[model samples]
Target chain A: MAEIHLDGVAHSYLPNPTDERDWALKPMDHVWRDGDAYALLGPSGCGKTTLLNVISGLISPSHGRVRFNGHDVTTTRTEHRNIAQVFQFPVIYDTMTVYDNLAFPLRNRGIDEATVKVRVHEVAEMLDLVVHLGKRAIGLPADAKQKISLGRGLVRSDVAAILFDEPLTVIDPHLKWQLRRKLKEIHERYRLTLIYVTHDQNEALTFADRVVVMYEGAVLQVGTPQELFETPSHRFVGYFIGSPGMNFLPCRLTASGAEVAGQAIPLGGTVLAQAAGASVLEIGVRPESIRLADGGAGLTVQVRDVEDLGARKIVTCRLGDHELKVKVSAGQAVPAERATIQFNPHLTWLYADGRLVR
Target chain B: MDKWQNNRAWFMVLPVFVVVAISAIIPLMTVVNYSVQDIFGPGQSVFVGTEWFKEVLTDRRLHEALWRQFLFSGLVLLIEIPLGVMIGLAMPKKGWTASLTLVLLALPLLIPWNVIGTIWIIFTRPDIGLFGATINTLGIRFDHTASPLDAWVTVMLMEVWHWTPLVALLAYAGLRAIPEAYFQAARIDGASAWAVFRYIQLPKMRGVLTIAVLLRFMDSFLIYAEPFVLTGGGPGNSTTFLSIHLVKIAVGQFDLGPAAAFSIIYFLIVLLFSWLFYQALLRVGTGEKR
Candidate 1:
């Protein structure tokens, strides 16, 4: 395991990244500690995969440096970087037996035949692929093939890191959960520096020690899953991280409180200080943070629609003209249409120009 | 999607099947009929059961021609397959160079086969041709007209130059079908260049290589016009492949009965070899263990 550091790394497919729009990955600085499992999480085409590729050394940044173990690896070959990567689809040799496919890297590096067999068997067992080790890979189911792809990455213990690019995307839903759990167990047991890239927040949150939320070519926030859920540094992160996602309602900030659709909701002293405007100031709230207020000061809203997701019910409500969602627990009854729902302002995050005001 | 009852579907496939049956089935029936009969005139004939087949099998002249054809086809495959694959791998992955390379490779394929033979025949003459004059000036005794070895060499060289591009184009298409992620995965695995080619590129190219091999094999086996023009069956019978031998009997000697029987046998051999190639490819391709 090795610590990875990125210092203002920027890249573009075009020669010149003259503007923010030109860069595939915008200039940013971050670090992932040794043996830490980090997930680069974002929507598709949001540069999360690009950042992962950069870390794997398949791509070089147009500016700045990437350091692994305090040594610059910005321009290094992926082979020289000593990392194993599992792609979105399995890259297994279909003609080779499962055992041979797993044993490929070891054999290529000239490991002895007996040792190769032992190692391949061990990885197959860990991945629960031992029973079919003698079978050919081409006829395997997609999920089994994905397991082979994962096992291939995990089999090599000498590598500095293992990168997975949406490795579970091709897997079945139930199998995706099983594989995520297995990856967590593997990371704990071996403590390898594992970097997983995914667009699904649930997968990222469940598998990684720390989640790096990204959007529009920039790393929005890097923190524990709880920290990201509670306090997102960027508005996009707030909107992207949750299932119904965080609600953003346009508002104006004044001395005493913030005005949402000409309604004054008194804010605490701390909340007011964080509500200073730069441009397009808005108030943000996660669904779980807001509730159907009893009689205290709150904004009036009309219920739009309600979604039943088994355990929790998601109520899409309109606060003035803006559509917002609020989550109600399984035990709670959903309010009727045109219900005047109010929310707790203490949990609201004030945003200015897409970033946290303070 | 849509229901299969649409009449347009049959319209799309009818033309192809009609074209194939007309061009292939009719000629094949004629060959089969000719193989089983002895024709004395246009309308007079007598059925001879397997007589021509027995004769062809026993004829030393047919054996020599068959052997020559086999050697030529093997040589052509050996030279073209690897050379084509290497040139394909060397091509640039993207941009104007890729298009330029494709157009350049396609130029030889556009030339008619007889035209290629004519061009090479003139180009390799001992006196009038540029290649012949240049070699003569270099003091090499390269006389193709009377030298069997020289004639064979010239025929082989002409075929290679004329058909290597087809193999190269097919190989390039195969290489292009591979996704970029596979290479990225290899790179991350720390695989050497040769390792990547052996394990990844070569296995992926098997399908295309099969087609290329079979096409080249059939083309080389049936080769007549080029060698006939360039070498005229050579100083001796060194360049006399089976097709040339059949042509000589049918057209030169005007022995229609024997020639027709020989043509039938020749066509059967090509069909048999192509079927064998197909079976071998299917086993390798779809039978890979999972």
Candidate 2:
């Protein structure tokens, strides 16, 4: 296990990072603790995979250092950094047998044949690939080959960390759950430093201990799933972390209350102190946090549509002219034509520009 | 749009079949007819049961030619396969450099086969040609016109120059087909350079390598033009490969009966060897051959 420190690391495919637009991965500082499971979570082209490659030593940062176990290894080769990576697709050797594929790294390290055999069998068993030890990898199905790739990464016990770059994206949906659980189990047993990169929120939240949320090549926030859901640092994080996402209603803050669509919603004593003197403010609320208010005390909305998601119903309602979505239990009753929904001020957040308002 | 009808797909292949029959089947039938009879002139012929086959099978010249053909094919395959793969790996992966290298490599493959023979013949003349003059000035006593070893060397070098790019192009296509994910995985696994090449690159290249080997083998086994022009069956027939010997029998010496029979035997040998290579490759490609 090793702690990885990214000290102002930035990367660019072209030399000199020509301008602000030239950077593929924006400069940032982060430290991933040893033996901690972390996920680089963001949408595609958000530089999550780029960060993983940088950590694996595949691409050197255009600026700053990557220190592992307190050793500066920014320019070191990938092999010397001791990282194991599982690609989005299976990358096992097709001509070699499953056993040979697993044994390849160990053999390359000049380990004894008996030790290689033992370690190969150990990883094969962990991955449930023991039965396929003699079968050539080329004939295996995609999922099985992916497992062999996983096993190859796991076979070496002395690695600094194991990085997975959306390894479950190529896997079938039905099988993805099992692989995630298996990975979790391996991390628990071995206590290896594991970093998983994915755009899927559930995969990231469920697999990693702490999730590093990124957007447009910059790390937004590093926190647990609950923290991200409860309090997002950036507007993009609030919008990206949930299904049916968070809704941002245009509003202005006053010394006493908040103004929304010409209606001054009283900030109620508790929310007033929080909303005091914010220059540019937008009210943010999760769909599930908005509840239907009885007797028409809250903002009136037109019921645009209702989607029955079996587990939960999504209520798509229009607040003034902006569409707002709210989640409720499946088969929940709704008022016909128009209704009023009260926003839970405690769960809702206020953001100024793109950042959270203090 | 309507769903695709799988049953009518056979109609798409009719034109191809007709073209192949006209080009291949008709000529093959003519060769078979010639194999079974003796031609006295362009029109006169006599039916000869298995006499021509017997003559070809017992001939000492046919045996020596077959041996020479095997040696040439073996040497050519040995030189081209590894050289081409290395060149393919070393070529730039992207941008203008890759296109420039591809165009340069493709130049040799574009030249006509007969032109290659003629060009080599002129380029290696003992007195005036640069290659021959350079070797003679170095006091190497190199003369393809009079020396069997020199003749063999010249033919082998010419064949290598002409066909190595074909293998490299195929191998390059295979290498490019590999996704960046595989290399990422190799890096994460802490795999050394040799291990990555031996396991990932070699296995991925197996399909292309199979095709390259079969093509080199068939072309080298039936080699005719370049060596024929440079040495003309050699000063003592030392560089006389099977195709050159067969051409001499049917055209120069006009031993039509025996030559026809010998041509069939030669074709069968090539067909059989290629079939063996194909079978081995199919097995390995399918992960069932090994």
Q: Could you estimate the TM-score for every candidate?
A: 0.93, 0.94
Model 2, residue pairs in steric clash = A83-B188, A84-B188, A85-B188, B283-B289
Local distance difference test, each candidate: 0.85, 0.86
What docking class should model 1 receive? medium
* Best lDDT among the predictions, by candidate number: 2
How would you encode candidate 1's per-residue C-alpha lDDT over A58-154 as one tens digit per residue? 8888888999889998888877787788889888786788898898877777789988888898899999999889888888998888888877777
Candidate 2, residues A1-358: lDDT per residue as tens digits? 7999999999888876667777878989999999999988999998988899899988888888999989999989887788888888888777788998899878777889999999999998899999999998978888898899888878888888989989888888999999899999999999999999999999999998999999888999999999899888888999999998889888876666677776665555565666566566787889989886434678888888888999998888888778889888885687766888888877877777667654
What DockQ, between 0 and 1, does each candidate earn?
0.55, 0.63
Q: lDDT by residue for model 2 over B14-128, one digit each (tens)?
A: 7898899899988777888898998888889989988999989998988998898899899988999999999999999999999999999999999988889888887778898
Error at A358, model 2, angstroms:
3.3
The all-Cα superposition gives candidate 2 an RMSD in Å to the true structure of: 3.0
Model 1 residue A179 lDDT?
83
Model 1 bad stretches (over 4 Å): A268-277, A293-297, A330-338, B1-21, B285-290
Q: List the residue pairs that clash in candidate 1.
A: A136-B289, A136-B290, A137-B290, A138-B290
Judge the docking of candidate 2 as incorrect, acceptable, medium or high.
medium
What TM-score does chain B alone reach in each candidate, compared with the true chain B? Answer: 0.89, 0.91
